[model samples]
Target chain A: MAALDRSLLVVIVDVNPAMWTAEAAGEHAPFVPIIRHLCMFINAFRALDGGNRLAIVACHAGKPTMLIRADEELDRSLHTVLDTALVLVLLATPDDPAQYNSVMNCIFAAQRAAIMIDCFAIRTSSTFMQQAAHMTGGVYVEPTAQQELGLAQLLITLALPDRACRALLRQPKAHDVDFRAACFLTNQLLDRAYVCSVCLSIFHHGDIIECPACRSRFPPPPRLARKRAKRAVAPAHGGPVIGGAHAAAAGAGSSAPRPAL
Target chain B: MADGRDARDARVSPLITFLVGQRRGRLGRLYANPWTCEAVVRALPPVARHYALRLVALGDTGDGATFAPATLEGWSLAHDAHQAALQWLLDLSIIERAEQPGALRLNAAFREQCGSLLCGLRPPAPKPPNKHTPSADELDAHAAAQWDALLYCVIHPSEWSDSTGYDMPAALLEPAGLIAARRVRARADGDDDDGDGGDDVDDDDGAETIEVWAMSKRGATFVLQDLSAQAWHILQVYIGDDERKLAFLLELAHMDFGHGYELRDEHRPLIAELHHLGIVHVRDAAKSKSFYPTRLAAAIVSSGDISPGGSARGRAIVESNLRVYVYTSSRAWTAILALFLRLRTLLPNAVVASITRERIQRAMREHGLSAEAIIAFLTRNAHEQVRRRPAEERDKALTVFEQIRLWERELERFTAKEAYYLSDFDTLALFDAELAHALASGTHLWHRREPGNARLCKLVLHEREDVIAEARARIKEFKRSAGLA
Candidate 1:
């Protein structure tokens, strides 16, 4: 088993109302079924002796909060969710007003909290997942399917053992992980984006390529466009802004605010 | 103690504190207070944190070496070697060699310390024992008595056996002011009540049993439980370093004092039980001639191969070797150190005195001091300031690569200064041949041909006297063959 197998895992679920509602509409894993699967997986993890531990966080739109099952409720908690079978249908029904309200409250709170957190646009969004997995020694997987619980099975087979035991067995290769991350500003994935050299905030389009945090403009790579601008702009220092990619972007018609760290 | 104080005053970085504490078992205590090593602390070295965390995890075991090295290597301890960790535990008196070499054994003191710490951090497993469950109060009392008895034995193990006529003072035991057990005689005045005549006296047979005042099993068990894991560890480590103390501890195991009523040492039964707990080592005492302190004893008190010499603990022990050289300075070390204070030499930090074999043996034979007790005194106070080069430099200073080169260079210079035989050779070819031969024979330094002679070349080296002798002999041989001498 790899060290990850022996390490304690902490899962922070994005329980944002808007996000989960979108996911429930078949865009991602539906909230009720996803949660049911998560609870079962957590139970399975907790069953491990000596080396395994699990904790959960429900990240609502407004507030990211712990969803730690009460120690006393552990036996009934996960099992109850698992036994429900058609949990999504029950949760989606309009009859149970209280459950719907409580679930919505949790989702809104998590989303609000998550948005308030420092947001940064990422050209390649792999860092976020990589960091979470690295920190807790758990695999980070965001599933597109709400109906299937494939991730849980993957965890059971691959990520359950400790690093030591993992060394002896075949492990899921690091390369297999999707390294892409969604941009903080637009929440869209970008291929190549401008970044603040100081705070390393990525941007799609902005007036200044210079880092606002440090007031240091990124030196643009030399090119035909920059050379032409250099002659036309008269080098902004004692005259006009120098011909550079940053200067050109500032002059361009694109109107997107740069992302902040 | 000075080193510890200095570190505190310096406000040593948390990493350093952790490292120092790692050697001394202080970090384990700190972590017990719910002070977690925060992830964001910039001062903390990632590498050090990794090792410290692994050590803490390993310490959680019922036995100190609970996890194998291979198991740990996969975890956060990917960088460290198994031997390096084993060595540290050995230094801390947490792990040691079993009866056989290469086999790992856990010291009881380490087990208790780790167990309690881990238990405190995380609640104990909810599973109840399969055996009879005692009330909470009963458990507490049992633990207390066991600790107390162990402490008593640590302070005085001889009281467990009768072979040694001397009885250790009860006050020496921690949780002070306990009384020692001794046989009391029936009062002669009792004769006045029952005897009809001076020659005739009738007594109840039960008086013999009532005459002896001894510690009860419950009391012994409580005493052992009361002892702090640290102190118990010190005693465990102390006994192993010295041959005599080890034998005494083994003897306690053989006598089955735990089962019998006659207490030899007030703490003997407790120590004997500790041996079974794997804190101390005692082989089949009933059949064996004597017992020896396990690796646990040597590790807790003494500073040797456990941590490297340059490490804090090793350095401390090395420095303290002068006035009083204790193999260990544990409580046991202090007790032994006090036994042979020829004269007090007080330094600002450490106390110095000479604890001799004769003095220790005397304490054993006359004072009924158990071998483990004496070794503890030695280990706890071993001189920490031996005047030696640092461990790193000692080996690096004369590394094979540099030493050999330097020696060759020095010899070359000495040969250059002495003008020996090379000045006599007339031809460069002859000179080169002669120089090669001399160099091969380990004789020549520098050679240059002179304008006159045919057989020899101008040679320079520091030691001219020896070179001249050899040159003359060569010349003579040449003359005999060529008739040119």
Candidate 2:
């Protein structure tokens, strides 16, 4: 029998109560209408084929609230799971940097597995989401022109089709993506940053004292000993002596070590 | 996925399949009713259902009635993925090519009815289910008794013993091709198995021939089919060529199961036949005010997909030790289990049985059930709990199925078949021509180019009269084509 392209749509609905309930202050679209559109879109996806499977993750307050399957184990499963998986993120809130690594991990996992990751940024356009959609060969749509009015139609036309038909689809023009990592401690996007060698944590500050995520000290302990040696030499020679740690730290931060050859 | 490969699915109701074969006018008329639309929607393939659900809602009278086949609604799906679904819709007349080349139009009758349905207009609501209504179990027993007694007439023909129950449903059995008349010689001993269905008749003079009704080959296979298929097969026979009756049956499939509905005048005769077949239950078949669709009726239609072997309902759990727990109370189901299962303990609702090698061999040798059928029966009926179990535990359960197959292989040597052997060929050229004809026609079971002499060859053809007739013509045609006149 011919193998069917059985789509596995993972719809991560932004049910963040913070975003949905922000009516007076923030201009977020009504929750009910978005949910209704989502439901119709889900129905449309199911209509596409009989064997298609879907997982809806309701992210309440930017945390996976309920329904089915843990998101934590998804990256591991991506290797074994269906190739036709499409993770559609419907983001309403601003970027939650705490979940950046996880989101990025999932995006890369999806990319590696050849799974498409479509992002519909409702309220705020996320740089990570844009990059994710761009990398994974999926459409990134931030339909900010008319919030509620053509949401359903936009979703069906743009994101409903899989990667094969998507080539022909008139997708929402993707803006420039910031292929930059955010600091775990500062939560600020950075072009260049220091990464802890042990924990792989990003640090943008001058000299890394300690890793914020894994709490592993980033060579500052060795720097203190090097400072003591410099101080001991300074007293003997009464002259300025540069610490070896400074030269070592600069060369050590980058991913790979230089070969002598 | 054509999940129906295991079971002859009621997915496209045998009724719908029949209607599809009829004239477009009759099929369109059938689609006129909303209930028929509802039934068709249930039976539609998932992809096709998806399009119908959207398009039918858009099928209003005025503007935007037609949809472009190449646009978002149709074209949004992957190109190769749903072409089959689109074609299926066209075949069923749910959608058709409009005047323009690329445009598609929903069937007018189907759309109108489906539109009314989408607008929430429905047939009279089933009266709120009564608290005092007979329990589902009780109804099962009632249906079982009525249905089994009818089938019992087939299995243990009442003529042989004093176990007289329902009259020989020869009207049903004969017409349905479940049983056929065969004239047998009434010997003094009368110990033949075929002698039981005593439709014995004295032919004019001294007792020369006795016409006995025996089970047909179709009837033998019918027994192996699960309940849903058996029910549909009967309906297929019952609702032969009657478009109006078939329409009513589709409408009936839409009705609530277990709830009694008022039987209209038009449906009275149909209800009588259905009641006799234990599909629908009426207080009195003579004058019925209301008829309740039995579980059998519900099983045939309401169940999403009905396979020939069985529904993969996962009603039974197979343990590592080969013990089986079947969660059903139906006597008919138990009767099937008795074929291969070593029934250990029979509870009120569950049957605890063992998959013994002896029982498996017996079921194979006596009942002619294949190892694959037995394994499929177990797999399809695998308990939900078994699916939920850990991989190793599930694998353990799987090994039990493997054992049954292994045992069957161990015991198997040669199987018998009924076929006609043709021998006597003038030359090798003639023999090769006939062999090619039979093989191409699928009637050639076995053939030998030369049994003894190079001139003569042995060939076996299927014994079925229709197949033999067609094979003979094909063989002659091949001879003529080869210029071996």
Candidate 3:
């Protein structure tokens, strides 16, 4: 039976320096105060449903990291409960934002050492905190630097119930998610490019005589001699022949089938 | 745990081994906590609890389950722990497992029995209850109220002392040290002089409380008063051997109880009480999970139609019924059944008895049985049959209207009997004592009392014990007030 009473709520507190810096400049609650308040709110939620879950996400520079993931396992597979926080000490460095994965790895390793517990992903997902909470049927809360939304209020009201009983009420829904794909070619997000009709492969400019995806060849046309033969057919025929030449030309034209991958 | 296991192993034998192996079959899942154990414990009736507790205690280690089939009772420990515990522990987050294998461990902080997590364990502030105990009079009044509640379940408040069986609940007697020894007395055929006319009567001895097993004036009053019409009828059929209540329950399983009756956890107790009453029998089905009703349970519903037969005919029914059903046929059931006439039946097996309309009408007329009382008798018997389905079933099949009709015709022959009247009391003290005495005698009724015009409290009695007892108490109080005693 679907347990109608239990629920899990995961609050991913994004502590990215670049993101929070912008927010800190705004006329809103400072990031530190928000984090402190969010922790207390999480405690309140745990009191409501003592078994409800909470996770924190910190994004520094552009790398998203986890500050606190309740460690009940010891594996990378969302199942491991390790008291590990992925904190990036090098957030102050002006490194390329693309080095985010490396920063995340360091943060995860540091958090693991602090707890001295193994990490297992048996029940949790791959993302810094969102995926872990998602696997366990918990709510995922990730506040970005761009919005000065009332995240604390949202946490209190929305993340109260455990996952089992949360189905009846309307909750925050993610509709237009960022589905931009990272290119295998340059490892950068791609917008538009030549796609292989047969294999659905995408590519930049290549030889016109050959298809890059399937390596199929296309024969070039003999231009001058073909035009001279057309002139010969027009003189040999009368008005019917002029029209016959057009018919013959029309008959000669044919389209090839598109190639399969 | 090991010491307990060794003791259990010492008692093991070949037949016992076979029984334990058959009972255990297999144990599945592990329950390591008291929270889990409590769920399984509550589902069991007291008898099952007695055995199950012994079984579990003999083998259970206070940790996650370790199935040691050979060590304890020679049975496999393959029972599902969560099922036994009813999943309450899962709700508490004290134990986490999955319906299937390979589920990840959700992280939870482990708290010890330390000060950080203790919520409600403050030492309660001392109170002066021990220092200022209630006075003797107050204690007596409090004890009376508590005793009344327990006793009230057996006999209705108005008919408390009038029950013929006079069997007080064990709870009441336990405190009073009035429990009768469990010995069957030697019976004298014709030599027993049962009347007040007997030579050299030993009546002044402790005989005041030692009423005869089957018949005594106070005991008969109590037994009769204890008879709700339906229960009385159920006893009648069992005595008649018409049908065992168990068989009736099996047939009733096919019938419907109106209004989607959802049998809840609480209803189990009420059903168990009926079983305890010896009105029905439930047996474990062969190699199955649930219990099946036996043949004796079948006639429970029909028994409800019986009116309270008077003492003469009722006694015969009780004796005959007692002879047929050896187990669970209580003295109270037999006494209640003795009210009808010519109850004997020459049956080869089970009960081959028949009750006539004339006998029923005669019983009503002689015993002053009310129409409501007669109907109540049949309905209570019918309920055992009806309970086969869970109480929460949509349609309850037993018809109350049918039983009521049976009594209406039977009651026409009865003549009104006058009860004693006591009124114009000068003091509250007089009125209260008289009321209590009247209630104790099991004959008090609000219907006989009128207000303002009469200035009198009236009580109707087929017997005047209620009034007589009350009058005696009032006279004593009156003398005490006048300083004559």
Candidate 4:
């Protein structure tokens, strides 16, 4: 018999009030139903193994905080329990730009820990969340409105297995990953961008004399050269298209990049 | 006590054996206590614990209808895990077949307690005063000291005799069969013939034999196991057939580490037992004082992790050349290492030892230590040097580990069993009939010759008692009918 594989699962919930209220008015239910489904999924995960642990983190507009830290709630004092996390489940919609840094910090931490960050985009597709999931070798699924009833099923079928079980079972793959980067200054997704050499921060426009992030001053682009570069890169519709063809089709009307502030 | 078979079967975990021996009524009463229920749930194997949790959750949701056999079969895809979980639950009397066919139900009291636990409705015990509460480190120190003293009493009784001013619970040790009072003295001048090196025998002559204490084989095995496992084994030995002590120990297993619980009147004797076993430490021992559960007590029912105190001090640096460096000055630990390793040198803070085939075999054949237990001990106590090694380099020690296991397996290769070798029948037909009966009953071990023209057969162990008896009765009838009675 194989040895028992202990695992820790971190469930990150996007408790955005406005999105849930809008969904509550629509066909999708409010936070209560979603929470119920999440609770069922958590119980299922816990049932996988006696040593398996579950932690719940809620992301509000201000800062992401751990709603239920497994170590504290279960009173686990073992060092093994504290050292590693196996999976991170993010139930999210479109998030506020202010929480970008904090959410990214969580993603990078999970990445460094070798944790799979499974993203379940409930209402709207989050490009940042997709990137996080893709980079971490986790499954990213944005279920349509008709498939909302199968949220719990999706969690069990797609994200329940640990790395060991994933070795034998066929895993869900993210077909089209949005590689678009958000401008550090405006926190806006940019289709065509210029990156700062020192800090590697992306910018929406390259006309500035000094880099906004690192203040690395460079000679301004020649006026005639800037116009030629703009005409060469601009699409026929004069609109910035983010992501690949699949993403553009899924987010047809919402594909326009936010104007630079 | 009966034979080697009984002794070998006794190697199963004492906790499981004790739980299996419990009566349904006693088990129900034990489970009625929330603490005992929680401990039992936590002590179950991983698969069994998951099954219990799922059942408890179902009970909370009032889903009794789904517990039918047909529906429950879909619970897990792994058939082995499902079967093992069900068997364990049945053995512990946690669940039983219902009056209706194809249905199962949890014991009423167990179901209620488990439901309460899952729903987080268990009422917390009254809080003790914050003052005088011990820190985690202090508790660890007390636990380690108390445990070491107990082990010293068993492993090195000579050293135990030199220590004074501390109660050693010698009487408890005697009853647990861990230590026995014996006589020891230096060899006399006139009796100097060398025969065998009997370590426990008194070699003195024409003089009074000084009484001393020595450990038994069971005591040797006890010292080598981890602290939590040792506590359980000791409790099983001390409790014997008493169900109340088992219940109390289970309740103690549920107590939170580093927290003080009120010392009720009924808890006095149990607390004293735990104190003697080094599972808990009482501050004042007064009637109304509170008792703190040490790391040992709290971790007794934990499935995977050992106590924090032991984990910190269990570091043993093992080299590929079979040399070992244990970083501790504790006498109890040294005594344990001496059982399976050739001690070379003892420094102020470390002890150097080497693993040898003879020592390992002696531990397995004489002391009843299993290969799995030894492997688990070494793996748990692996030092930082070994732990930090790259994955490819870690396989270097695998050869040594395999050798130790092979030595142990060699000792267990031949097992003697009690069986009846049947022969000498007047007719071949009678022998054939008897052999057929034995085979049909599933008690046939082997046959010396074919039943066609010979009359030799052997029957070994049977799963049920009635199978052998029924076969014997059938053989007697056949003999009478053949006029051979």
Candidate 5:
């Protein structure tokens, strides 16, 4: 037999608590069909190449568990031959901002390892998933309510294409990312957040006597809070030109008592 | 080596066409079955499989079969192997041309079946009966004993009488071309020369005759093939042109390795035959209600990863220095290596060996082993350690194969050919003209030139009398026209 140019595919199935039990969401998330779709998609993927190796991983409450990995002999030896490795994430829950840094770190590590991360979300595309897909140059597919009925078809059609075939095919383009950083204090998505002078701890509001994170002492907030609050509010509703002007003036005025980190 | 491989391909390619390309009407339903689909995929080339799989994933959509060929990039329609790959998919009916000119669509049945199979809709194999069933290891041992006994009987029948374990029917061996029988003039002369021929006689013709038995040419090459290939050949021999039986054999690959399926009235005869062939484990062909598919059965449609019977395990580490370390207790592994390698040490469950030139040459001469076959076997069974090595270091391992190839070539000292030599040319122009004519017809072999002369003095052409005679007539006409007659 000729030595085939084999590739490795890692499929991560996300079964987070929010996926099945829909307390806030209206409908029961057709678990059987989704599983059916995933299985069909994997079947189609495996069919595409005889030599292509695959591993399945289930991520639920805590750490991810590898459900199955074929041919353990190729475990780490795969890294060198792992040039064609692709990591696919089937995400159901929306991104939790608390785990944003960890997710991004994971994405960065995947990037450094040169593995592509493709995401197929249930209904809405999560922000972290979108970024991961975008950074790795993989398709991020979010089926519409109508398309979700034929999720198996969509998953197979869009997500099964390898790196070379994906280049030639029409894929679901990544949408415009929010690019906003979440505040560490409230875990809320924010366009602009107040940063502590000492610890650089982010928050939605600026009314604080001391840095909560670093315990750095500061003068009472009445004078500093009033000015920082106005500067932050004026730019969000204003035009880009006005926002730039406001930001520049605030930076110029902030030379009074800025703490060195 | 190259000739041997091409010949084997000539034998196997048609088997693919035969297995997969059945009655078209029956094929749609066959495609709807996952087992059939699995078997079909195994028959296709790697590239065509990729293309078929991609198109299958594209789905029928009901909007119209997708315009897929247009979406595919970097394809050249004019004389490309990629074109052949596309044609193969079309031939297999995995995909077909749509209403649009270049559009291709997936077979609807194939697509739906792939979905449900992956979706876990297929029922699991039934559990074992209350009676004891053979374990996987026991099955392997049984298969090995059966296969080795059959092979030993065919290769050397002097040691074993009819009472031993494997009484592989001679009827089965003849059709496979493993053993051949011929009636020679039964001379009442020297008995010493009958060392290789078995004296199995048929007195049905009322003539005093002894049937001489020997391994055929196909058998020489057949002996060197791995277990999967050998099993497939055996099955092909069993399932000749019977389409129903061919389809039935494909089911074994899809069946669970150790599970048993109850045999129906129609399937009983086939299962009994498969039992003798070591494909299925049927303890009592008449009394047993069900038959178990052995690992050899898996090889009927197995891809490379499938560890078929006793053969497909990758326990050997073939290094750059031509050293082989086999970590297998199976005699099959050591015996195959012994065909080409010079053994140095034999520890328990392991063997140390080196590939020496003389052994390879001897195997080439005696066992009809080819360099390509040896190299292919080594790489196919190579440990993951070889796969993990750096690319530069990998080249070193490759060089070892190249050395083996060179050694094979080194044995070819000269080639003999039949040709007609034409000489004594009067002019450079006439010599060149004759050379051009011969070259155009592809009968010209070579021309000789003296050290001091620029003009060709002699030309050698192929030994085709008709072509040579035609050339003679043309030369006569030319000579008369040029006033040299």
Candidate 6:
């Protein structure tokens, strides 16, 4: 294959006002160091290839929006242009669940275009962003609060390679993807939830007759005799349960579920 | 110099090779020129370019004068990237090892000039503006026409009607071994082996076909490369034995396309030289005395995607049935197509053709074209219809592509190498000892003991002289010990 002459990089920053404020209350201002490192990383990428481009997207109040474009002035209200992007870097924190759909739409679109989405989670771990990175074959980095290995160091080491060079470099492997999807109804994380077979939308309640997404009617789920003893048999695990209905229900109700998928 | 040969053997990009092979004083002088420094930095590989930029960035900040080995560790570079970047820097003389054991200092001239260039601190040298400067479209047209004509002249000499009014110096190309001229008798003399019947036509009824200059293997490889790569290869050929000429040409790479530079007395010959190579176009031969750098010139130091008129993307439309429709009216492009395709018809805007085994084999055997080269050419010029599809499914002629590769592999199945054989040892002890010696030297190919003859053994292809002498001495010693001399 001919060498790639140009590559488009899209950086997604999670700008949750609350998280930044909480982080600022600590010794160091949280966003300041990250923003500085991000600028350096962008410069490094631009210096690497003159034709390489960058676009900055900010996830504000659960709404995924564009903050800056390589050519255009910074605009907070604009939607991201992900079509031409070869790599998407997301600086995420534990964000609002409400923006999950829009953020996921962007992630899926980037995935379809074969755009790698690298997620650098700050203090809080954003499960959905992790899923975005994992599903799209990107790196998911969670830098420790310690100053020894800073965000700039991680960015330079892990996220410098474009698509072509990524093939040669050894990427950081994601331990386990959090596949626990959010419910469409309440936006709550679901474990042992009912899946709308037609639309595949997860729901916390199994008693509903119709899928809220597809509006398809279904025959009632087979009712097994309630067995409390069977639910106690399986131990509580941190990972998402990957089994049929029986294991899911027992695993979900038994413990506080970890966010994933 | 040995460095030039090393560059040639490694096939380094022409610009970088030129820079690496220059004398230290000349190189420093070249870097002192801001335009040349900018062009050299632009032509560097991405990782090396990044390292230069990073160092310049550091110099911009009032940091330490030299970077310690630990500074690179702070960048957190991967092992391979760090090694590659350092090797390139050292090879290009961009950085030198410091007297201090673990430190490196950037080349002072390169650092200063490149920093100024990158930081936009140094304005470009003043050049007088001319009134008859060509537009971007005009420059593109001139580049395309001139480049196409040059290629057509090299590959299809009979079709060289001098339509572009640009004459390529065949003597100049001879040293590069890109094309070779051979005298052929007129077709009327009954030489039926002119299979294609394309370039063998007589100009006049009584005229002979005469000399036919056909493309050599290097020329085939040249034509198959992307236009930017082709320009670089040609430039390397033209810059042979002239580092000063290359330094001037490298400066041209930093010039903006469609911009006119006044033709100074010193630049006139160089400009004329560039005009011959299709890198620059003179605005007017009579009144106007300015030259415009074409897209080809600007593209040399920039990315490879900047083809003439942006037609590099998907120019040839290949159908699922192995038929091809190339959307180009240039005679040079058509001539290239004729190399491997059996042309059925030619339209004003396109040429219709199909892949035939006989035509492909003829190209492989006669023209020295490889299957990979053909595939690359097709892929580089694939039509928009094919390009718009997902990359995995884009090659509609994939089956034919595989078949062409298989055919090429068939031709490569047989190969011959030079080797020496050792045989007729005096005894089993001598044979075993010689075999051990050959095996120890790692020069042994194969060995065998003659059936029903325990005294004789053979070893094939031992290239080392010392091993052969030792084996001979051992055999003689064994013969003398047995009193059989």
* CA lDDT scores, all candidates in order: 0.36, 0.64, 0.33, 0.64, 0.65, 0.66
lDDT of 3 at A131: 22
Candidate 5 local lDDT, B357-454, one digit each (tens): 88877667665667888887777677777777788987887887998888888777657799988776656666777789898999999997654453
Tens-place lDDT digits, model 4, residues B1-485: 22222212223434666677778777777777766666676556545655665566555444573367544446556555556657778778887778887688877787777655543443347356587888778888888877787887777654554232444546566677877776665446524221222454565565566666677777876777766567766666666766567667666665667788887777776676566556777865546378877877655655444643645744788778998899988888888888788889999999999999988887776567777777778877888778888988978877889889899878878987656656656566666666677787677777655555554433343445676677568778877987878
lDDT of 5: 0.65
Q: Deviation in angstroms for B458 in model 2?
A: 17
**Candidate 5 regions off by >4 Å?**
A1-125, A135-138, A161-169, A194-201, A205-261, B1-32, B39-88, B98-105, B108-112, B115-120, B129-131, B147-210, B305-368, B378-407, B418-485
* Cα deviation of B469, candidate 3, in Å: 29
lDDT of 2 by residue, B1-485 (tens): 55222222235545456556767676788888877777676566544555676565344324556778775344433443356557667778888788988888889888878766644554555555565455556566567666665554454342422232334446566677776676666767764353222434445566667666665555545565656666766776677777667777766655666687777887876776676666677776557566777656645544343422222256888888989899877665676677578889999989999999988877676546777777767776777787788888778776887898888887776677899988767567667877887888788898888745745678898887987777577667866887877
Q: What ranges in model 3 sit over 4 Å off?
A: A1-13, A17-29, A53-149, A159-166, A172-179, A187-261, B1-485
Find the candidate with the highest DockQ and give its number: 5
Docking class of 4: incorrect
What tens-digit string does per-residue lDDT give for candidate 6 at A179-255? 66666788887655655544555566655666666677755443442232123323223332223333544444422
The deviation in Å at residue A64 for candidate 4 is: 5.2
- lDDT string for model 6 (B156-206, tens) is 554555434544646455566777776555666444243554544345656
Tens-digit lDDT string for candidate 3 (A143-218): 4443224433344434443232234333454322222222223434333232333433333221144555466543
lDDT of model 3, residue B372: 50
Looking at model 1, what is the TM-score of chain A? 0.46
Candidate 1 chain B has its poorest 10 consecutive residues by lDDT at B34-43
For candidate 1, the docking band is incorrect
Better of 1 and 5 by TM-score: 5
What's each prediction's TM-score?
A: 0.32, 0.56, 0.25, 0.60, 0.66, 0.57
Better of 4 and 6 by TM-score: 4
RMSD of each: 22.0, 12.1, 26.6, 11.5, 8.7, 11.5
